[model samples]
Target: MLDLRSLRQNPQAAKALLKIKGYDFDTLRFEELETQRKSLQSLTEELRNERNVKSKSIGKAKAAGEDIAPLVAEVGDLGERLDAVESKFHRLQEEYQAFAQSVPNLPDASVPAGSDEADNVEVDRWGALPEFNFEPKDHVDLGAGGMLDFEAATKITGSRFVVMHGAVARLHRALIQFMLDTHTSKHDYEEVYVPYIVNADSLYGTGQLPKFAEDQFRIDSDADFYLAPTAEVPVTNIYRDEILEAGRLPIKHVCHTPCFRSEAGSYGRDTRGMIRQHQFEKVELVQLVEPGRSWDALEELTDHAREILRALELPFRTVVLCGGDLGFSAAKTYDLEVWLPGQNQYREISSCSNFLDFQARRMQARYRSPETGKPELLHTLNGSALAVGRTLVAIMENYQDGDGRVHVPDVLKPYMAGLDVLDLG
Candidate 1:
């Protein structure tokens, strides 16, 4: 939510920045509401003042032993009018809040102007693509013999779900452990555990509620809780409504959790294999920093994600998301696309974004500066060090041998209990 004072000061300037995120708020309605609110609030104050004066007059009249009844009647009438004005003002305030919630956060000036992914600019590439000795198999073909069972997952949970068994399931766990260890140990992030379900306020704080609810799965029960689409929700909101000291400027957090998505409206897209699942795992990274240092943090954070790809020797490229293709909460984003030789394409394996203070403002997450002794919003950022399911896909396709076996990446060997390759039955 934008500060009310900022809205009143220069709404146009604010609106112009929001245009980069593709929002066109109704200026006339906002102006008209402000006018009414001012009038209505003034009226309420006047009625209260008049009643106070009349009450005093009535008390004095009684003390003087004359005409107190008339004064009492007049004061009672003033009370009724005050109630009416209070009701009106309350309604107007609610309307204004709804309008404010509908407005998106403004984009940073550094973001490129474009409407879609095609317009995104490539920032850099990482590692080298795997050189295969024979035809490579996609994850589905490679895992089928080892119990990466799609048919069973469908029977138990329906399509867009996969149930890995035996070594395949253990391999998935190994991938998550490897990524989490790297993020927390070498990358200097604090490990955290967060709830898988959150309230609407938490969603709104992250800019995922109201606008993107359709893409999510919401509970209709009494709790009114919604299944989180990503760890980004609970992790990013750890500091919601919090005030941190300036010295605590950049707080880093890394979390690993299973993500659930309805994948609504994604019909006929990546429907094959585990490429696009309704439930998957991910290792997430979050940072809270001073406004001046957030951009630098963005680059550093992007490198942190690329490290996982580099260690695995997986080929990947980083691209800057143009304004149109950016997430609703992000001012700018860089998606890390990992190479998959089987599909002969680079698939998005991680996404690093700098949301600036957009999310912090919504979350009311702030830090008090030591210099000014004043509190200010801290910039919040989050990125997937790697999406576990996608990383699993990348490894399988990249390491497939001619005999229908998959070689595990060296860094993942410890977690895999010294296993080198997963051979088919």
Candidate 2:
């Protein structure tokens, strides 16, 4: 929710920012509504004050043994008028809130201006793409050594699903565990286990509701609840509607969970392998920081993701999203695209964003500043440490030998119970 003061203070400034986001919020109408609401509120208060004065006069007249009937009747009539005005005032406030919710956070002036992803500029690329000897197999072909069964996945559920059996299944589990362990130990992130089901408020707090609900698997209801599309949903909402001490300025958390998505519009993309899935495991990182620290926190969080990829020797690049490509709640975003030989390109595996209090405003997640003894919205940030399934895809394709076997990454060997490679014949 935007601060009501934004419009009350400067409706024009709000309108200008909305334009850059491709939104033309009717500033004129909102200004009119605000003015009308204020007028009604003032009148309602005025009626109450008058009723109080009338009641006081009635008491004085009764004490003096004078006629109080006229005064009493006037007070009763005022009470009815006050009730009517109060109801009207409440409705006006509701209308104002509804309009504000439809408006999104203004894009930070620093954000690049563009119309679409094609306009997104590459901020930086990390690590070089690998040079392959022979024509390498994609994840699907490499895992087809009979353990990774896409057909079985489809039989059990539907498309964009995979059933890993035997050693492959173990490797999948190992990857998630390894990620959680690494993030918790070296990254200073407290491990958290969150719900797979979340409410509409959680999605809205994370900016996934309203616009992307179609991409989610929602449990149909007016009290809208949806299967989480990512651990980001539940983890970020852990502090929803709460206040904290400034000492807890930056709350770092790591969550590992299975995500569900409808993938409604992506009917034809990543149709093979686990690259695109309705269900997949992932480890997410979320941070709640003091407003001024969000940008530095974004850099640190993005690096935390790259650390996992680097540990596994996977090449990747980081791209900054353009204004048009930015997520609804994010002022800025950095996407880490992991190298996938299978797809013959880098694929986005994680997105680290600086919401700059955008989510905090929605969730009312605040911290008390001792300096002024006032509550302030904390900046919220979240990133995929790595999507476990896609990283697994990267590993299998990038580490496949000329033979049918796939060598596990050196760092992941311990998680595999000292097994260094997976042999599939």
Candidate 3:
């Protein structure tokens, strides 16, 4: 949620900033609501004060042997009026809150202006695209020999899912382990295991609810639980409604979890292979730092994610997300797109974002300031160190040999127990 005080103080500036992210802030409506709220609040306070004075006078009149019927009636009427005005004020406040929640975070000034991914600016590139001597096949074709089974998965569940067997499955698991190890050991992130299911408040804290409801796999229960869409959601929400001590200024956590998405808006895109799946694993990185340190944290976090791709020796490019391409909660974002030989293009493997205080405000996650001795909202940042499935796809496509065998990246060799190649028996 945005700071209501800031919005009220400078709605025009807020409106202009929001426009870059494709949001049209209705300043007129907001001002009207504010006016009504103020009027109602004043009236409510007056009525309560009048009631208290009238009630006291009634008692004084009774003590003096004077009839107090008029005073009693006046107080009763004030009570009724106060109730009505208070009710209206509460409803209007709710309306205002809903409106505020629907607005996306304003993009950072550094973000480039664009409408979509095509306008995103590539800031850097690492490693060279591999030259395949043989025709490169996509993951589906390469993992065809019972290694990546889609038909069985379809029979067991549905489409947009796959079941990997033997070495391929082990390799997928190895990628998760490798990423977790790299982030925890080298990147100085503490590993955490979070619940795969979360409540509505958690979703709202991460800016996923009240907007992208259809894109979630909601559980069929009265508890209003939903499948975790990303480790970022549950991981970042660990400090929801919390105020940390100044000593714990920077908190970094690395989490590996299975993510579930309904893909409600994506009806027919990337439906062919593991590129888009309902169930996939991700190694997520989340950080909470003091307000002034978030931008630097973003760069460090992005590099941590890039380190994973670099370790795998995968060619990739880092692109700064345009204003319109930025995620709902992110003030700024850097997407790392890994080269896929099969797709013949770079596909997003990780998205490192600095949400600033956008998510922290929603979550009410804060830290006490040493100077002011008052609680202030902390900055939140999260990124996919790497999506396990996409990383696996990149490995299969980029490391495939002419004989259709997948060579394991040297970094993952220890995790795979000396297994160097994935081949069908």
Candidate 4:
């Protein structure tokens, strides 16, 4: 949520900044609503003053043995008028809040002005794209050795799902364990386990409720339960409506959970393999830090995600998301694209973003500032340490042999029961 004062004081400037993110925010409507709210507030205050004076007169008349019926009647009328005005005032405030919530965050000045992903700027690349003597196969073709089964998943649930078996299933689970262990032991993130279902307020705090309703799976329950879209939603909401000491300014948490998405807008994209799935597992990293340190923390968090790819020896590059491609609650974002020899291109494996208090404002997550002894919004950041399913896809395609066997990455061997290779023999 934007600061109402900022919108009221300089709406034009806010509009200009928001336009860069491709959001044509209506400043005029907001201005009109604000004006009405101010006017109503003044009238409400006036009515309260009139009521106070009438009540005083009633008390004085009663003390003097004079009839106070008329004064009491006038005060009652003032109360009725005040109630009407105050109700309208509150309704207008809610309207303004809705408008503000619909608008996306203003992109950081450093973000490139682009309309789409094609204009995103690549920052760095690591390792070499793997080469195969035989024409490389996609994950679907590579997994035909009885380890990956989509037919079973389709019958059990529907499309955009997969059932892994034997060594492949073990590899999938091993990937999640490896990621959690690395983040907890080496990256200094406290491991967390959160619920797979959440409420509407949690979604709103994470900027997913009103805007992306179609993309969520809402359970048919009394409490309006919705399946978690990502671990980011639940873990970040842990600090919602909270104020923390300055000493606890930075809180880092790593969570692993199954994410459910409707994939509403994506009609015919990445419909093959596990690239785009209704259900997928992810190792999520979230941070709440002092505002001043968030930018540096973005860099650190992006590197932390890249560390997973590095450990798996996967070739990948980092790209800064352009203004138009930035998430609704993120001022800036970095997407880590891992090399997929099967697809002959780099595919996004993780997205690290610095919301820079955008979500903090929505969630009311704050911390006391030592300098001022007042509460201030802390910057919130989250990134996929790596999407576990997609990491498995990358490994399958990159590590496949000419004979169709998939070689497990050495880093995951210990977790894979000391099996260095996944053979379907």
The top-ranked prediction according to lDDT is 3
Misplaced by over 4 Å in model 1 are 45-74
Please give, for residues 54-138, the per-residue lDDT of candidate 2 as tens digits: 8888889999999988877766667778889999999988887777777777777777778787777787787778777888889
State model 3's lDDT: 0.92
The TM-score ranking, best first, is 4, 3, 2, 1
Q: Which ten residues in a row have the lowest lDDT in candidate 3?
A: 71-80
lDDT of 1 by residue, 1-425 (tens): 66667788888887777676667767788889889989988888888888888888888889999977777766666767788889989999898778877776667787777778888888888776777667777788877785688999899989999988777777889999999999888999999999998889889889888778987889888987998888889988889999999887689999999898899999799999888899999999999998889999999999999999999889999998877787877878899999988789888888988888878888999999887888899988889989999998888788777787778899999999878888755
Better of 1 and 4 by lDDT: 4
What lDDT is reached at residue 144 by model 1? 71
Model 3 lDDT per residue over 135-180, tens place: 9999889987789999999999998899999899999999999999
Q: Candidate 4 — which residues are off by over 4 angstroms?
A: 49-71
Superior by TM-score: candidate 2 or candidate 4: 4
In model 4, the number of clashes is: 0
lDDT of residue 360 for candidate 2: 89
- Candidate 2: residue 360 Cα off by (Å): 1.1
Residue 234's C-alpha lDDT in candidate 4? 97
